[model samples]
Target chain A: MPTAKKSYSTGAFWFVAPAMIVLLVVGIIPLLFALWTSFQQFILPKVHFKGAFAGIWPIFDAPFVWLSNYRDLLFDESFRDALGRSFLFLIINLPIQVILGLIIALLLHRPGHEWLKNVTRIALVIPMATTFAVVGLIGRLLFNGDFGINNYFWNLFFGHKMEWLADPNLAFVSISIMDCWQWTPFCALVLFSSLTMVPIEIEEAAKLETDRWWHILRKVQLPFLLPGITAILILRTADILKMFDVVFIMTRGGPGAATELISIYIQRIGFRSFEQGMASAQAIVLLIITIILSRLYIRFIYREV
Target chain B: MIRLIRRLALSATCLALTAGIAGAWTLEEAAKPYKGTQISVIFLDRPGYRAIMKMLPDFEKRTGIKVNYEIVPYESTLEKEVRDFSSNGDLTVALVDLVWIGTFADSDYIVSIDDLKKQFPNIFDPNYELSDFFPLLLNAFGTWNGTVYGPPFDNYSGLLFYNKKMLKDAGFDKPPDTWDDLLKVFAPKLTQNGKFAYALQSRRGETQSCDSFMRFIWPWGGSLLDAKFKSNLLSQQSQEGLNFRQQLIKYMPPGIVDFDHIEAVNALAQGQVAMITEWSAFYSTLADPKSSKIVDDLGVAPEPKGPAGRKPALGGFSLAVAKQANDNQKAASWLFIQWATSKDTAKEYVENGGVSGRQSTYKDPELVKKYPFIEPMVESWQQGVPEFRPRFAEWPQLSEIVAEVGTNMMIGSTSIKQGSEEIGKRVEDVLSKAGYYDGKKKLAQ
Candidate 1:
């Protein structure tokens, strides 16, 4: 029994040893170093390296600072307005992705629906595979303020022109539309895959109880897909939190910081200003907020199931 | 067989390593004049680099000293230069922007030319004909605290670029001479088919902070720093300057505030704008047959006057030897700098369309005839002052505040007075953190 215990400990050590080393070197050491540095103010190219043992004191020292960076962000009213606009995007995109995915999954899973289903699945998944950067750039070109194809169509439709990214309200909507076009198919595929995992027995029982399609979906299919929907929301919120590359390369938080997000603000402080210490503090705050929101999500929604 | 294959691979690896080390040794031997020496030069990878590359063969041939050059984009080079100086490394021979000389000089990044003259006269070269250089080019970016820091390269003082054809069509024979004249004569001509009258780079970044904002600031008789490196952006003159830029946007293309250097240049090249206040280097691109729509019909002049007369923003590069460099590499680097900025060399460069800061280059009758923009540039340079690119270690932070607030002002999102005051407050805060200011007074004393 002693020999077996020894062997089991050795086996576990070997399995976790690489990851432990990586975590120590890449994660813990840097986190500790950043934590030590964030308390002291920074000027580019020089810091006295006078690191005192400042625990969570820096956070408490300026309770208003969180509001300051946020206030600096609020100076641009366009971005403030975009928060509401983003809701419009979420409203349109969420349902479209879910419905399209569910319908496709239903048709494809119907036993005999093979060729048509496979073709549709391949076609739908292709957009998901395309790089988001390329998609956003193409979107910019297609919806260019002056010469884009969309502008031409818009002129034909309304007998007038629209500066897609120039207008504050439209700029947010443009990015949202691009995000939806690129990511809706991805959500659909994930939801569709989850739909297949739904037990056939449950669906058959529900159908017999109600001949109505809507009733079957409301009772059987959607309830089965609840976990998938939650996963998508969690995944998307996390992804959106760090949305930098596309927005950076495209708008550059421009037309007067209209599309500037938290990530953009963080990048400006960290890289452009060379205030790494403050950037680390900002990052820590953003992380805490993300964690709290995630916890709330799990508490309110996931625990109910 | 597996053992034999492993042995073969090992032998090959050893051979490659030996070859690599041998190549490195040869390179080191060639740099014997600067052995045990490392010099770091931070510069922009643009026209400034082109001149450096052109003269590298000559430099290596003469000095036998290897040059360690790091070329970054123009926007980030200032921060990188500061980092190179602040770090423990012997960062010798940095190519800094003209505006940055003050910032670098204040922090003791590079040895002052005054110090060099006293201690290292061989490097100073009083006979180097510093007087021959354009006084504006020499004084505007190079001089700090009454001492020169580095020689100028590829001068890019702002010039008024106009469409001669457009001006003629607008019933104007000459380009506008002042801000008021620009609005009165050119704005109407420039606005056609839903296009702006003038194109200016107002996008947030270095361009907004250094070029566009400074262009307005200087002409409006405003400055960024006071005598003691304090913020002066909230001055009455500065407020007026900020407002002038915002008002100009009214007559500009839709989204003028969003236009970066490339976009502004493109607008002028495509004949979308009648005039553009831009760098002199832009003339080369505008005249290029492949890029410009109206090549022959283009004209250049001194930047239009504002309240203070023609005060075009200065933009160029300066070569400063790193303080941490060893005596030998410093000497070798100084030798290269001397040769590069020599009257003969600068004139040769000017003849090749490389704008030289040396006044002697402008006096070269053939050179002036060949490049007509040179003389007017010299005149503009003579009218030039350093503005606020004086010795101030906190200039970089001040630049960011200016770019951010100036951009807001241009878009009409914020009032000029409000934006200027905000910039002043932010700058004062930064300077106070640096111990350069104390809100109501300078802290240096």
Candidate 2:
């Protein structure tokens, strides 16, 4: 019995080794390198090295400035604006996505809607499956002030065209709309799957207790949905905090830095400005914020579930 | 029989000598050792690259070198090249923008042409007359400090592309010859009933900095920096230029702040706007019947002069050998660059929708007739500012700041004074941090 158990354990360890190695190589190593880079004054253009291994030596040669890169971020107005914009994007987009997703999930959960639910389930995957960059391009076309379909309809309905991408406020809203379009379906599918796990007997008992649908949902379905909602909050918060491709592709943080999110700002600092240390510092700060937010979600929301 | 044999040998020797003289230095000979070597470069989807692609087959057939390239948009090209260089990736040929010369050279990401020639002397063609390239283009686009890093390939000069029919309809027989004329006379008459008089490609990137914002400042005798590299944006001439641009905004399309080169070109091509100050290379697109609605009515002219005489926007790219490439690959890349930019291939390059930097190419009567934009482009090039956008390692950072403030000025979100002052302050900060003021680096660079 002991020999058999040891053999099983060995097999399991071998089975998981490849993924663990890959995670270490692709994920953990880069994270550590970035963290190390954050501590130095690593201007890319100033670093001079040659030969095949030159790419690896720049980090070693970079002057250590301790926490000055992070300290500079405190006084940087553009960084502040980017952070504020990212938060505003989250504030505007999260609630719309959550509420719309819940409503869709509830409707699909209704007894007589199996065929509709089946079709919607398939259709909902399309937006979630679409590439983030492609979604941004689609958003650009959709919100184009001159010849976009959105403007055509806006002119038809509002009797005037709206400069969706030109106006800073409208550009933010346009980005939010694109984000919700891409991600609300994800929230819906998750919540819908959670709804399936709700015991039929418990639902029936709640219905008998109160003829009102809202009462039954509040008392019975809400508890069951809490776990899925918690998962959504944690995941979506992280995703939104790091949202870059769509905003970058669509606006490029245009119309005077209206849509420049934290990620986009980091890219500008690191790649465009060649200030890798400052960008690394900003990235670490963002990571810390993401961690704190995730902890809050898991502690408060998950505790209830 | 002996006399006849002697005559035959003499004739054979003469034939051999003629063949040797004719094939003295060819791309085929230079690329002989590097045949079958696959080199990679990043190309844009612009007319010049399309021309290169059209001519690529002949190059491959003659040289036996396989050229692989990734076609990316202009905005992404810098980042892609930087990432590749930083990682020592497989990019053999570096397609460098004019502004990137300082940065790429400072970082040692690309080898200088002289160094490449020294390293592989056998591969260089003696007949590749580097002097044939316009001196202005060679200095601005190809050289950094004192070293020639690459040869100018895709060259441009800002020219006013307008719809002749629209100008005629608005009671203007000719394109505006000055900024004052454009704003006061042509603009007021042309702008009406949802049609704008002009469109400036001002999307918040290098376009805003180089083409839109700097386009105004340069012509008005306003420079981005002084001889000491201090910000000159708060100067009287600069303020006048900014104010003029603001005034002209009334005649420009709504959402003009969001227009990129493509959008601005499309506006004129589709007759939505009367005129656009665009790069000379875009004439091909404007002339193509499939893309342009006003192909028959298209007219080209040098950009209108301001307080300063014709100081048009100068922009272009050069092809260089990547430092990361091995010797053989570097040789192949250099050979390819030489062949592409050579005076021998200049006419073919121009005929295939490319704007060649070779002065001799433009002087060809056949080429000038075939491409109507050539005369205006040549005029602009002759009178254009060399430092249109400051070429230095710190330019990318400074350009971002200018782009933001410039766009804000265009949209009326910020006053011209406030925007210009803000830009000056930020430019000082970037320059200070780069050690320019402290004399750690030379001020001239």
Candidate 3:
């Protein structure tokens, strides 16, 4: 019995070794390097070393300005504005994605619509299949005040065209609409898979107790789908925090920094301004926020039946 | 025996003559040692890059050096080049924008022309004639802190491109001669029924900073910085310019604050707007029948003067060798730059939809007649402001602040005075952080 237990442990070590090494190389190493960079003044252009080690040794030699970058970022109005904008984006997008996704999942899970279910599932994947940057370009064209299709429809309803991309509030709404359009499908798919696990006998019992759809959903289905909802919330929270390519391609945080998210702000600091230390510090802060939010989700929302 | 000796002597003399002619350092000969070296650069989708692509085959055929390029948009070019340089990536040639010269030069990301020449003495063609380029373009686009880093490749001077039919319909025979004339005379008459008189490319980013915001202040004799590199934005002259821009906004399209160069130019091309001040490189687009609605009615003229005088915007890119490139790649890249910007190739480049910086290219009567924008472009270039946008390493950070506040000012979220003050304070803070005030770094030239 002792020999059998030892053999099982040895077999598990071999199975985990490759994944652990990969995580160490690609993930852990870069995160550690970024953490080290946050504590140093490592502006790329300022590094004066030359030759083969030019890219390396100077980075190590960069002046250690402990907490200076973090202090500066705390006082930076642009960074604060970006952080607030990202949170606002999350607040606006999270509820719509969650509720709408669950509704679509429930419809797909309804009995006696097998053919319809396949077609609807296939159609839903189209939005999720489109690349983020291409989605941004499409959004740009769709929101253009001069000749976009949205303006055409809007003019038919109203007497004049609307400045969708020009107005700050409208532009923010447009970005949200685009995000929901692209990501809601993914949320729907995840929730639908979770719904497939709902036991028929329990749903039948809940339906016998109350014929009302809301009552049955609240009592039986929702409790079963809490895990999926929690997952969606945590994933979307992290995604919205780091969202960049679409916003960059669409408005470029324009019309007076109306849509500048934290990622865009950090990109401007690190790549445009070459202030690597500040960017790294901002990244570390964002990482901590993400970790805390995910913990909150798992702790509070993932209830065991 | 005598006849054979005479024939052999004649053949020897002929061979010697051919070798002597080939010894004059042609680009093809200079590229001999680095025949198979592959160099890479970032290019834009603009006319200038297209023109170069059209001429690239000839270059590759003459010299065995293969040139690879990635087409990047203007907004991404700076970041792409900077990232490539920092990482010592595959880019062997740097396509530098005018504002990036100081940044690139200060960071030592690019090798200076003098250093390249010193390193590769035999690579330059005798007929290159560097002085043939316009003095203004040479200094403004290629030089930083009196150091010649690159040679001007894609050069431009802002010119007013107006629709002649629109002007005539409004009872004017010609474009406006001054900013006041444009605002008071042409704007009121031409702007009506959803059509605007003019459109400024004010979309946030460098377009807003260089094309829209600085375009206003320069002609009013307001500089971004004083003699001591301090903020000059809150001065009376600068405020006047900023206010004038605000007043001019009413004469533009409803959402003019979001119009980029493509949209603004399209407005003119599609007859939505009567006039737009744009770079000379866009002439081909406006001239092409497929892209323009008023090609036959298009008229080109110098940008209208302000209270001070004509101070057209100067913007373009230069070709420099990357510091990360090996010696062979550097030599081959230098040869390509020299050949691409040589005096002999200027006419061909211009004919292929490029705006050449060579003074002689504009002087050609044939080219002037073919490309109507040439005369006005030359006029602007001759009198343009070299520092239309401040040429300094800190300008990128400063430009961001200006773009945001400038856009806010246009949209009425901030008054001209408030916006200028905000920009002034931000600019000072950035400059201070860079140690300019403490004399640790050199002041902008």
User: lDDT of each model, Cα atoms only?
Assistant: 0.68, 0.89, 0.88
List DockQ, one per candidate, in order. 0.22, 0.64, 0.59
Worst 10 residues of 2 chain B by lDDT: B21-30
* TM-score of B-chain for each predicted structure, in order: 0.85, 0.94, 0.95
The residue-by-residue lDDT of candidate 1 on B1-445, one tens digit each, is 9999999999999999987765553322333555434445665655545666677666666556666676676756665666556553556787766666756666567876666556554444435777777777777667766777778876777888888988888788998989978877678666887767898887766677877787778788888766665567777787677677776776787766556777788888888888898888777778888989988888888988989878887777767666767777676667666767777577656545577778766776887777757766777787777653443555666666677677777766787778777787787777776665445533321
Residue B208 alpha-carbon offset, candidate 3, angstroms: 0.9
Error of 3 at B195 (Å): 0.8
Off by over 4 Å in 3: A1-14, A48-60, B1-23
| Candidate number that wins on lDDT, 1 or 3 | 3
Clash pairs, model 1 backbone: B92-B322, B93-B321, B93-B322
Which of 1 and 3 is ahead in DockQ?
3
Q: After superposition, how far is residue B440 of candidate 1 from its true place, in Å?
A: 12
Per-residue lDDT of candidate 3, residues B371-428 (tens digit)? 8998988888888777888878777888888888888899888888888889999999
> Which pairs clash (backbone N, Cα, C closer than 3 Å) in model 3?
none
Assess the local accuracy of residue A4 in candidate 1 as a C-alpha lDDT between 0 and 100.
59
Q: For candidate 2, give the docking quality class from DockQ.
A: medium
lDDT of candidate 3 over A202-273, digit per residue (tens): 988887888899987888878878898888989999999999989988888888898888999898888778
